[model samples]
Target chain A: MSDYNGQAGDGMNWQPGLRESYIFDRNTIEEIRRAASQGIYDIRGFGAKRKLPHFDDLLFLGASMSRYPLEGYRERCDTSVTLGTRFAKKPIELKIPITIAGMSFGALSGQAKEALGRGATMAGTSTTTGDGGMTEEERGHSEILVYQVLPSRYGMNPDDLRRADAIEVVVGQGAKPGGGGMLLGQKISDRVAEMRNLPKGIDQRSACRHPDWTGPDDLEIKIEEIREITDWEKPIYIKIGASRPYYDTQLAVKAGADVIVLDGMQGGTAATQDVFIEHVGLPTLACIREAVEALQEMGMHREVQLIVSGGIRNGADVAKALALGADAVSIGVAAMIALGDNDPAYADDYAKIGSAAGFYDDWHEGKDPAGISTQDPELSKRLDPELGGRRLNNYLRTMTLETQTLARAAGKSDVHNLEPEDLVALTIEAAAMARVPLAGTDWIPGRSKDGF
Target chain B: MTTATDVEVVDLATTPLRELNQRLHDGAAGGPLRWRIVNPNGAHAVAVGVDAPFEIEIEGHTGYYTAGMNKHAHVRVNGNVGVGCGENIMSGTIHITGNASQACAATGRGGLVIVEGDAAARCGISMKGVEIVVKGSIGHMSAFMAQSGALVVCGDAGDSLGDSIYETHIYVRGSVEGLGADCIEKELKEFHREELGRLLTAAGADAKVDEFKRYGSARRLYNFNIDHAGEY
Candidate 1:
């Protein structure tokens, strides 16, 4: 076979330009270019994008000469959040604003979900259940668990609903807005099947929509049902895809939701079509502003808490989301990375799976090299839950620290106090959406008379 | 005239439902308290978290989320019910003598719910372990994403019936508009017949055993193959 560069691997006889002209210094770039030339778009596996204006785009607008900074060790900064107060008589008071988003048992093993709960508990935050119903291990480990009620209704139960700290009625996910969940048959182990109440070996198709009501009017009733089931004790959250966010957020609030979770296109999933992930929903940055505007317009900004997810990777991303008007941020892909996904040491096994290092994202397959996303016994054995939980905890702590550092630099004592004025964007689209100045200039195209 | 405590009738009209619930919780009333709830008109979350083993009777049309999260309580609605009636119910019984709106018994874990009239879409969706018996026809996407449980329909079922159903068993006597992806018609074995019979008895329906058809998963798309890469 020819070399990847389309050149023969002759011993000591190869000449320059025998394959092709190379402009980039890194081999990864070359591989990307080669793949792109063949109609394959280089997809994001895990890492910050080079082209986009991420959380680092804005600087902390520190306290001015007139303002005084608090002593690092002496002063206190609170990061707590209360969700679902509108309907529930008693709402959940989270220790931290940062919470773990829902990740299902079918997409990941029971061990992974357990680890997530454990890590979030250690970090003084909350964990969530995904499309699948509540598992004993997940509910037991999480300090404050948010049970998700998706279109699929897998694993849903009254016992779990009563037991949950909060309920999230998921209208749509970011990865595939109008699509259903597809847990390929191979990944459906006996335990998973039992939990989901499906056959042992069958491709599970989660419904794209609820069977009962079709519109917002019906949603109000759905919310009511959940509150009644929980005896109005637990809060209820409404989660929606980023598409048509302004209207969706408004509808969610009108439907009696106490908390609204807006997920953008960058959200990762266990299984979704490549076409849908890349082309379906709006970006998180844009969605946050729209959601915030909707809440602010209704005079229910802080009253109806907004939790934003999709593509948030680090402390900077969390800070940026907060600054963009989000009450808190949820991270899914980053959490998996912290659990040892995309580790270079697993290159050999990745190759065995017909994929090389940095090119493995078929999470639907049970033969995952990273133990976080597989049901296969061999793959799952490669991971140690204790170790994984520790790593995730460490990562969460680091992210919190980074967020605090940014908050302090911006002259704010609390992470939630960071505002949009504290940041600027490098790109025109980002600047317009975030309502900030363009990098290295005072121009704001939408706000200013002279467009940038 | 009957004395206030003569029939042990809980009047939801004059009394706040929460206070009545407290009264029930405190053991002030027992032995199937006859609840005469007047003007139940569209009140969201009317009868939630009722754990007492008593019977409740809603007089008129109830709004969204009626009889939600019920545990060991038998609730009866005299008129039509709104969305998500008896959702996430754990045990006991809920009987709608009239038509039921959307999402009847959605994600219910246990207990038996019987709808005398037509049920809207998403009936018994994501039911963890509940048994639902509908006497009339059901709307689109009924029982979509059901996990484990039993749903018996004496009338026709709407579109995308039993989509992504897990261990849940469905028996329909009437025609099915469509089957959801991966869901297929299965043979009505003896065990299934017995299960349907039990559900019918619970729902107080006199439907015949052979009248209903069974449905389940086809068991394809379990493992990934390079050839099937584009299917998703």
Candidate 2:
């Protein structure tokens, strides 16, 4: 094998043992070198700096000597949650406090959506449609389906609405608020375009805001319209991004929304400007507290269900979200991971795409290596639906089990009963937002006057 | 004229919209009834999926998303309509006798929508395969990011008209204050003139086709070259 350091030189004396000048950390230098070599203006569409507090900073404040712990296997730990009781004629009763958030068929493939529905059904949860209308395959596969009514109003059908288990009125997504949904032209296959009723191979723009309503008052009428259409049978969920969550949540409740789904900045999207994803919205942790506070102020806590999403990765994240006053937690990126997002087996293909194992995020190009987020025929085919579904089921089960473990440790019999008192924050920001005590201290900021 | 046996009138104020829609979905009861929706009362999603080739007439101002996802049926709204009128219609004719709110005929696959009055922002946005003829002015961001199909505005178009358009044809008789990203004015050729004339006649607009200006995509933003990728 030829040595990489061996250089062929004519009449040149070089020393291979001498080291160069040392400066910054080698890892940091490597990052800068890679970035400079790529000459990319700023990595777009992939992971970037998000303002929200990550899962690492938050810790669970498990029950102490004062509380009783439940038996791991013998005691009943109910994870079931009910959503949209304030306005819905029939609230949603979920087997677990985990539901699949809205991911459009236009953004993803029909097979992927079917797999999501299948997995969610197997997990005894609900699946939601995004900007695109309800597909027969997805609806048929999903035991409980939440139809989204977006600003674009693509594929929205009364028949589907009547057939749906619930409806989610999409005001905005976490990735980009007041920003339209984008499915780049390359991924806009004929079928996807047809489903959205747009032209083939064109970047589809879903409207950022509702057309008629300029404020909360008009939203009331809009909500009434949806209720009138569905005959008040299905729950109406109003989803908002984590921008001004306190006010938005209150407005959503005032608008007669049955359920409120709050998404934070870390939420995933099919296509969004990297700038907007990183710079626009608040973190999921901050948003959940504001939403919960708003509901509590109105005495609607647990009466109007609150679902939190964005950056939820594991069972610990789900349990923490519930403890932060969320009735349930929705997962998008984590679900995509379960569908094989960053698997190491596709290293060669990733290299071919000018990326490596942990650096591949070309979701907009439809050339995804892991087969979870791509419209390319070959790439999509790499994902076997059965296997993908099984994997998702396994991941979901593991998360449920982990949540049960945490619940038992917290001396809580029901997962929904997990309250804000069961969590603590390692940072001042998290403590203030989640209304929990600082790590290693029994003092909470607002609850105890002398704590600060 | 079709007989009364072929017509079914439902009062939306009292009758639950779901039951009415269910009846319509189950197929026309007691013959093919031209559903005369009385007392719409700002109700939304009226006659949304009439796939049986029937005709429905709404006599009042309707709320958000009226006649959404229409399929194989003709729907006529006698008064102004709220947001997303005729949204994602597959194949049908939606005639708005009065003004339509924002995103009129948004993402419709195949349909003929004639709006007699002004349409609010984002009119005909992401049009897809629909043909929209607006006799009056449209609001800001009209036709913003339209993917395909034809939008004929007899009156002036608002700011940012046809932003990021792709393969879609926009014909405006009056001034367009602004053009959206990747959208540029195109020469009004003979074919476009004919198309404009046809749309004008269909919409019952008396405006001369020669007066209209056509706009389309510049086609500069399709490929993701390193030079232009950061602009977004």
Q: TM-scores for all candidates?
A: 0.84, 0.85
| lDDT string, candidate 1, B19-138, tens digits | 655554443254434455666765667777677776677777887777777888788888998888888788989999999988899888789999999999889877878899999999
CA shift at A9, candidate 2, in angstroms?
32
Give the winner by TM-score.
2
The lDDT of model 1 is 0.78
Lowest summed lDDT over 10 consecutive residues: which window, candidate 2 chain B? B223-232
Give the whole-model CA lDDT for all candidates, comma-separated. 0.78, 0.79
lDDT per residue for candidate 2 within A1-452, as digits (tens), equals 11211223321443576443333434335557876887543334443343457566788767788878888888999998887778778778888888998888766666678788888889889999987788876898889999998877777666788789999989988888778866777887777777765567766667786644567887786677567556678899999988999999999999998899998888878777666787788888778888998999999888889999888888899899988889998988778778877678888988988877766666777878776667777777887777777787888889998999889989999987787777878887788777788888876677687746
DockQ of candidate 2 against the true complex = 0.34
Candidate 2: where are CA atoms >4 Å away? Answer: A1-52, A106-111, A131-137, A152-159, A197-202, A205-207, A211-213, B1-32, B35-54, B60-64, B188-194, B224-232
DockQ of each: 0.43, 0.34
TM-score, chain B only, every model? 0.88, 0.93
Model 2 Cα shift for residue A138 (angstroms):
3.2
Q: State the iRMSD of every prediction, in order shown.
A: 4.2, 3.9
Give the range where candidate 2 chain A is weakest over 10 consecutive residues by summed lDDT. A1-10
Candidate 2: tens digits of C-alpha lDDT, residues B51-125: 667788898998777877677778899999988888777787999999999888877767799999999898988
